[model samples]
Target: MTKIKIKESKASTSIPTANPENLKKQHRKKKRKILWKNKVKHVGKKKEDTKAMRVLPPKAPQEFSSNWKTLQELLKQKATSFDKSLPVTQTYSKNHTSKKENVKGIPAISGGGKMGKFKSVNKMDCDPAQTSVPLATLKSERTATDKNSTEGKGNSKEHKKRKNSDIEKEQADIKHKRRKSEEHMEQHLEADIWFDDVDPDDIEAAIGPEAAKVARRKMGIEDKPQLSVEQVLVKEKAFAGLTKAVAMDCEMVGVGPQGEDSILARVSIVNQFGKCIYDKHVKPTEKVTDYRTAVSGIRPKDLKKGEEFKSVQKEVADILKGRILVGHAVHNDLKILFLDHPKKKIRDTQRYKPFRKEVKSGRPSLKLLCEKLLNVKVQTSEHCSIQDAQAAMRLYTLVKKQWEANINAKSKRKCVA
Candidate 1:
């Protein structure tokens, strides 16, 4: 009775449940296949192409929509500044193809999408990259120079030319010279020249006063200051340390106004700095008066006959050359000397006497200055070379101090600094 009514039932087929493990295994196999494919690509031509395809900075994403059209414009723009090598390829095809050939097309693009706008893509399309100096900039630099400046030259060439000129001038200045010039040049160098270890035979032995009578002469010597002046400037340090002030007490034969009566006899040079470089009893040019034996001390027996004044001129000049000149009145001493010896660089304490207002004027005697200033008498018994040199040196330093003080005051700098 329960089965009286027969009802037909249509059942829908149910989908089988997926096995996650089988799905996982299949997915792993697919992943392995993809990985193997990539590995092969990495090991093959892709590796070789890396060295050939130099990496470039990424291109900016397309900024404009019709970017395909800009490729031709860009190419043309680039070509204007570079060598042109374009291959406009045209392909002809089958029936129903239009008689008109199509030029290479620039790929079209839509903007605002994930894909950026594209450029021309054809069989003949090629990437371009070449480097060169900008012609406009190079031309601008050339125009700016225009011979007013050396654009392409090295600075070394100019420096070498100037250096050579300086060298040539130096070489030319060294060849020629004169006697007076040499003396002036070495005026500041006299003290530096040494006489140590010289031959003893050069030393002279002469009687008092007569022994030092022949000390200066007017022999021919050049007069050029340039050589020695430059040398002093270059070597001032050598002269600066010379504390020894050498003085020459020169005695010359008396001369008349016309200088015709050349009574050349005795000349002496005594270095006031305890040095006696020269002392000689020069034979007289003319016969001596018999009355001079006691005072002049020239005995007829001791005189050497035929001793020319010219023969002894050089001996005297050398003695007086570098040292300071001192006497009662050095003017008379020089006047007597210039008759034979050239008046080179000679310093007279007498000329500086005017500065010593306390000292008597009108050629005060050397003994008087020594007695007053130094509290010592000179030439009382015998003319002492060392004593006279000391007096002259003292007088020089006193004057020098005054001069230095004046210079420091003018410059507003400390003296002896």
Candidate 2:
């Protein structure tokens, strides 16, 4: 009965059906699964490689040989040889020998001999009668010896005196020659004038009436009297009304320790004609801390009767009113006076372009500009307010035409714009 059922049960085989859309979908799904497995395996391999590289240690740096070591070894060998050649201990010979030779009549003493033996022999050979001689004879011999010594000493003294006198005379002659040479040099200095190219007549004409008089006196052409400080201030007040431009300068003294705080000590103003219009010493409001005599040239005696600050300020303001102010670093002077002027009317020689060729932005010193442009040496020792003001005015005069033209051109352009 079981055989009959087994014969009827045969293995059944199923076959897939072909559809273009369904086959394409199956192939895509299979490709995706294979790619995902390959990606996972590749990532695991990369992680294992990184772990192996991290576990290893880094290599150490190698050392290099030095060239100086060979040189040092050679030097040490030479030093050792020099040390071996030197004697270890000093020794003396048994015989006593002198490095100098003995005289022909002199006898050499034995090593064990004493010089006292010769001295005793000399004492025994002296005659007793010589010691018993009269005191008159001894005195006469002493006087004769003294006279001979005195004559010899006098001759030597006279010779030394003659030598000293000769040396002194030579020194005096050299000094006289040096003085003459210095005098000659001074004469040459006077002859070689600073402004040789400029005509003295033109300079005389350009100067103010007062300045021309002073120049003439200096040049031995006139005998005009010099003006006093008060007289000059009075004249400046009268001239300020007619003058269109003025140059001013101020000297300051220290009012605090270390000379850090500046206070007005002196003020000087000059017109375009280069004549001093105002020159006065101003007393500081604060207590005087430093006289600064070495730099300001203002001594205690000069400041004894100084004018009040307010009065000086009033006078300066009146003179500078409605006028072109020309100066080197004029801002410092105005600031000290506690006054303010229009910037358009101010001309600073320190900021002038032609004067700043060597230094592009830095302000050149007044002394340097005077020496270079005007061929005049200024501020050689102490500073003088009148001299500085005159220098500023002269510098302005040198380029006055060009400077005024530039200012007018700028004003015209501004108005047009």
Clashing pairs in 2: none
Q: What is the lDDT, from 0 to 100, of the residue 85 in candidate 2?
A: 58
In candidate 2, which residue ranges exceed 4 Å CA deviation? Answer: 1-106, 109-242, 358-361
TM-score of each: 0.32, 0.46
State candidate 2's TM-score. Answer: 0.46
Per-residue lDDT over 1-417 for candidate 2, one digit per residue giving the tens place of the 0 to 100 score: 555544432333222234577778889999999999999999999999888655322233322122223323333443444445545531121111111222121122333432222121122222222212223533565576579789999999999999999999999999999999977865664454444344344654454343444444446665435544233223352445337889899998888777789899999898876677789998778877888887899877777778999999998999899999999999999999999999999999998886788334477988887666665677889888888887887778778999889989999999999
Candidate 1 similarity to native, TM-score: 0.32
- lDDT for each residue of candidate 1 in 43-154, tens digit (9 for 90 to 100): 8877788766764433665522233334445434433333223333321231123223332222333333233334444313333221112335345544554543464355
Clashes of 1: 27
